[model samples]
Target: MKTVLKALVLLVVVVAVLAVLVFTWIGSRGISARDDPSGLETVVARTMRRLAIPRGDRNRQNPVPATEEVLAAGRAHYADHCAACHANDGSGETQIGLGLYPKPPDMRLSATQSLTDGELFYLIENGVRLTGMPGWSTGTPEGEEASWHLVHFIRHLPEITQAELELMQEMNPRPPAEIRQQIEAERFLQGGDPPPSAPHAH
Candidate 1:
């Protein structure tokens, strides 16, 4: 009993010292979204994320089957919703993606591809904390199924063809400015004056 108590006390002291050193390092480096996470930080964060997931969730199997229909649905959904950050090719090369600290992973890479289907689905539904990812759960069966479809699509990213990529580009959401330009161009073609531009912020 005395030995156990001593071991516990030593563990607490070691943890406290590590905490102090981490804080001191942070204080010296300062925090910035522009800075990439250190290797230690990346390992710690990934470990925490893995540990945070419930064992049942981590081991859960995908209920949806991988089929062309499901993959198409996932492709369209990803292009319209996730492409803004994840990119159509899952390259994570969009302007917003590049600016994010610890920017989104290239889904084709092993780091992302190696994750189990369950892990991918959980991350999509629940999202990672302290990152740009947002929980996409709609709390409905349909929503859950959509996320499952996405897991299959993520797995397919490595072999995505140019034809599929072209289809995704068509599905991607257009910026408001581009939409407005299209409207104005249509008006001009129909022999109408373009609408006046909204006042710009000073």
Candidate 2:
């Protein structure tokens, strides 16, 4: 029994030492968002995230019922705010999503869909630290309701239709320049007016 205890203690000490060394080395080198985490790093980060959420929070139920109205509100909110990072179908393939370190997961997949509704709601409200996700909850009833609606929308991700995606694209934000150009083009096509030429660079 003593030998077993000693071996366990030694193993724990060795792991702790190695962890500190690795942390120091990484800090010295400077971590970059542009760099993808290693497989081991990814596993560790995910495990840490899972462990950080309280069991009570994870088990909490979504108070909002799944209804068409609720779902529609969620869809609109996601399209306007989240579509930049998480695509309409939750594929997370957009430029911003791809650029993020530890790039956003494909939410339509089991890894995301399998999470409890409460877990999703808490994440939406609390946001993950050191990641791009921002907590949407503004400490208001409206904000909390929005997050709950989003949880419903996330659950519907697997069943999102192509038509719905097309509709969402219309809601997604466009760059100011793109919006201006599109408006001018539409005017011209309607025989209203041709847009003035852009200023030439020196």
Candidate 3:
């Protein structure tokens, strides 16, 4: 009995000492975890999974096949709301996005472990409760349509080239038909000038 009691006392002392050491280390130095893009991405991605509803068919949906009409609407909405943080090409917000403590997601080329249309809608319209993504929908077509348009734009973003991106931005910046007509005229003129069989620099 005495031996058992001594062993218990020794174990308690060891635990107390270890606890004090941990407390001292934490209180004196503190634990500021990594907050870089990668670190923030990791924490957010994990939290999203824990909180958001899981998609049963994540393997099937690519989230990038969008129609041209939807693409157009999305581009416009993206420019107005999402572009500042997500960037014009989903390349992530260089200036505004960086200001976040858990920085805004790059959503550019980083494959979201697997986010679906519904999950994305929930996050965007309702928000993740605490994450930086804010809900902007007022439950109207103009509002909801604009939000979905941004989603469609994001779905097919990776394949778009830098030049195409510039073109899209240019077209979306102005009233639709006027810019479309001008762009079409330019295309028609360019097509008239047949490509020399070989590449040349101006």
Question: Per-prediction TM-score, please?
Answer: 0.78, 0.78, 0.55
Q: Which RMSD values do the candidates have, in order?
A: 6.4, 7.3, 12.7
lDDT (0-100) at residue 98 of candidate 3?
A: 71
Question: Please, what are the lDDT tens digits per residue for candidate 1 over residues 1-202?
Answer: 9999999999999999999999999898887666778899788988899999888898888899999999999999999989999999999999889888778889999988888888999999999988999999999999999999999999999999999999998899998999888877876777667446743222
Positional deviation of residue 101's Cα in model 1 after best superposition, in angstroms: 2.1
TM-score for candidate 2, please give it.
0.78
Lowest lDDT 10-residue stretch of candidate 2? 193-202
Output the lDDT of residue 171, model 3: 40
Which lDDT value does model 2 have at 119?
85
Tens digit per residue, CA lDDT, model 2, 77-165: 99999999998889988989988888888999988888898789888998888888887889999999999999999999999988888
Better of 2 and 3 by lDDT: 2
What stretches of model 3 exceed 4 Å from their correct place?
Answer: 1-34, 37-41, 48-50, 54-65, 168-202
Q: Residue 50 in model 3: shift from native, Å? A: 4.8
List of clashing residue pairs for candidate 1: none
After TM-score superposition, the amount by which residue 87's alpha carbon in candidate 1 deviates from its true location, in angstroms, is: 1.2
Over 15-71, each residue of candidate 3 has an lDDT whose tens digit, in order, gives 999999999976876443324545676777767654655555222232444678778
